[model samples]
Target: MLIGEVARHSGVSARMLRHYDALGLVRPTGRTVGGYREYSAEDVRRVFHVESLRSLGLSLKQIGRALQDPGFTPSALVSDLIRWTEDRLERERELLERLRAIDASAPTGWRDVLRIVELMQGLDSASAARRQQAVLARSEGVPAPADVLAGAVLAESDPHVAGALRWALARSDGDGMATLAAGARSEDADIRRRAVLAIAEMPETPGAAAMLADALRDADTRVRGHAALALGRRGVTAAVPVLVGMVVEGSNDVEAAEVLGTLARDHGCADRVVSALVAELDAPTADSATRICLTQALFELSVATAREVLRRLASDDDRAVALVASAFVGELDGRSAGDRGARVRSASGRRKPRR
Candidate 1:
């Protein structure tokens, strides 16, 4: 067969076939009468073989070694190829993500695109300060896209930077909410923790309650605790059990207690909150510290609802518990009925500022 015939059949261009011949990768077995590069059957087969290897991301040098070196390790060669392909794929994916972020931002001109590119580089920078500045820097109408902010927020380890990113994400037209919701469901506990924390601050967010409700069931205590606190603030009853659990576990139990007290303000929710607290207190599993925390938490509830529970806790076995519970009872005893109601109302209504 002639080189033209082989090129036509093998789909390798003639120029490439000549280049392959020059590299000694595939040499024709004979010459035609016209002196055109001639290819015998074996040579044509070698050409196909080289092209096949090329399809697996092999360089010409690697393909030549694969075909010619008797000692070359095929498995090692394929492993390297796999690694290279994977690396290329990762780079391409990152590029695609940046492109998507830019497209999502809907930039109006080159300046917007450039600003976004600068922000993206800063977000991915090694310096936490640079990352912080990236999130805090004004875009002058070219807002950093929400997905970009969301990704930065999830990966951010610095507390101040993460707070800045969360604030930026919240203010970014709410597009980042979906990214945050997905992060809440991530298998990575750290990510879920950060996600729920960010979502917790978004009570004004439309679907944040549903995400928080799901997070209440997370295996990580921090994740679920954050979700419960966020949900409780929204007045969602679904957070009651988790909030009660937070109180029992002593995980931010004070904040948890305040939220519970907030929920307990509703007459219907009041009994349920008081009952869950009572159950934990009565359980032998609760240690002195757990009982004490539970007592403090219960104190957040209205005196009308938890007064009886308080009276029972006053004479409890633990001296600390008795002291704390006795102190709570004494304080209520000194209040007029209206003053007692006002006291509970005061505790539940005050909220620490969310980032």
Candidate 2:
């Protein structure tokens, strides 16, 4: 077959066929009467073979080696192509995400677009300070998209950056509550911990509350403690037990106790709060130190029932427990005396100087 005929039949452009011939990849077997290059059947088949390899992302050099070198194998070259394609795909995905973030920001002009893009890039920077600055910059103007802030908060390791991201997320119109909730479910403990902590900072939306409730059951103590503390502040009674357990474990025990004390102010939950603390205090597994921490945590409670419980604990069998409880009780008594004295003086002063 003539080169034109092969080009017509094989669909390979004549120009490319000439280039292939020049490269010795598919030399025609003979010349026609007019001196046109005539392609033999085998040469036409090689043209199809090269096109087939090119379709799989092979470079011309690789294709040439694949067809000419007896030792050349498709496996290694195919693997390389796969890796290159994956890398390209990853880059494309990142680009798409940035574009989406910019779109989500609804930038008013190119400057807004540039600022948001810069912020997004900074959020992904290796330097924590850069990431922190990005979040800080977000508050100054051109806020980051909700998804960007959510992603940054989840992956952020620096406490300051995480705080700024959380603050930005709370202000962004994007719906990142779901993202944070998913992070709460991550198998990575750090991600779960960060997720719950971020959710804790979000406004007390129903979704945020529900996510926090789910986090209360997380296996990680820190994750649960954070969720419980947030929920406790929101007055969710379900967090009471976990907060009490935090006191027992001595992990963020002080904050947990503070939450528990706050919960104890609610008349409905005060009994439950005081009872949980009393149970832990009375448990055989609670060592002397654990009991002492629990005793101190009781000071956070203002409920009369908790005070009565403290009075009873002040005479417990363990001298250390008794001492801590007695000291707290003494402090409480001293504060009450001062409060009464202040009230009396204020009342006397309100008597209009008898003039």
Candidate 3:
């Protein structure tokens, strides 16, 4: 086949074919007697492979090396490409986070605006111009036509803007929550916090559970507290055990108590949590707040088991326990003749049988 035929079959321009030949990357099978380049079907296939690799962001040199190695597999090459893409995306995320922090800390200013405009101009030459344009246009007060022209310029020249746009698309339209969850493991506190918040706002999917659980154990008390609150808001019942553990064993008992209260009310896990709380009360080191929280959770439980647990706690020697137990007795007094008599007997036992 002639060079034109190879170009047509491979979807590579004739000029690129000549360039490939010049670079000794993919030589034609033979030359015609009249000195025109001639390529075989094998050459056309090689050209397609080259184009595919190029599309995957491989350099011509890299493609040439892969072509020379018979052991190279597309899967291995794609694995390398994926690693490269992820690294690039990580860097882009870091940059965007920095930009967000800067935006949040300082009032918008001419210098910042100039810097953003310059960044946009740099991206105008990349594949993500249209997306960057859309993001810029959404900001307040930039007229539509000016935003378009500015975005076009940024898309053409700025690699960062292009990379950011690519990352945004991959994040928003693809597995963004998964990516953000991975980010949550970063040693940086800000990254972890941002990752948690980002994942919390994402569409609720089953995959999000593990991340929320991790956030519940985060070293930052505020982050852990927020994660628990968010999970409760989502009514993620699967998180009940973790939330209960936080209530029972948290370093910040007040925060844990508040989160547990919210979980009891919002996530419908009051029964399970009340049971854990009652068990905690029997442990000698339990704090007054834990006892109070337990009693409150029992009230929320409003079940036969709750009544039994409260009666047991009320019989304890601790005054705080007695007070909460008395409240539980009063609340249960009107339920039924059997329940009322049982509570009266339990209260009589706690009062030394009124001797």
Q: Count the backbone clashes (under 3 Å) in each candidate.
A: 0, 0, 15
* lDDT of every model, 2 decimals: 0.87, 0.86, 0.64
Q: What is the per-residue lDDT of model 1 for residues 1-355, given as tens digits with 9 covering 90 to 100?
A: 8877888999999999999999999988888787888888889889989999899888999999989988888898888888988999999999999999999999899999999999999988999999888888857588879899888878888999999988888788546888898888889999999988887765477887778788888899999888888888878888999999989888889999999998888535998898899999989798999998988888788658698888888998889999999999988787767787898899878967679
lDDT of 2 by residue, 104-189 (tens): 78988999998888888898899999888877766466667888889888899889888988888887777687778788889999
User: Against the correct fold, how does model 1 do in TM-score?
Assistant: 0.90
Least lDDT summed over 10 consecutive residues: which range in candidate 2? Answer: 135-144
Model 2, position 153, has a per-residue lDDT of 87
lDDT of 3 by residue, 209-311 (tens): 6788778878876567557766866766655655555666544455555666666666666777676776677778888777776676566555566777778
Clashes of 3: 15
Candidate numbers sorted by lDDT from highest down: 1, 2, 3
Q: Estimate each model's TM-score.
A: 0.90, 0.91, 0.42
Rank by TM-score, highest first.
Answer: 2, 1, 3
Model 2: lDDT of residue 125: 92
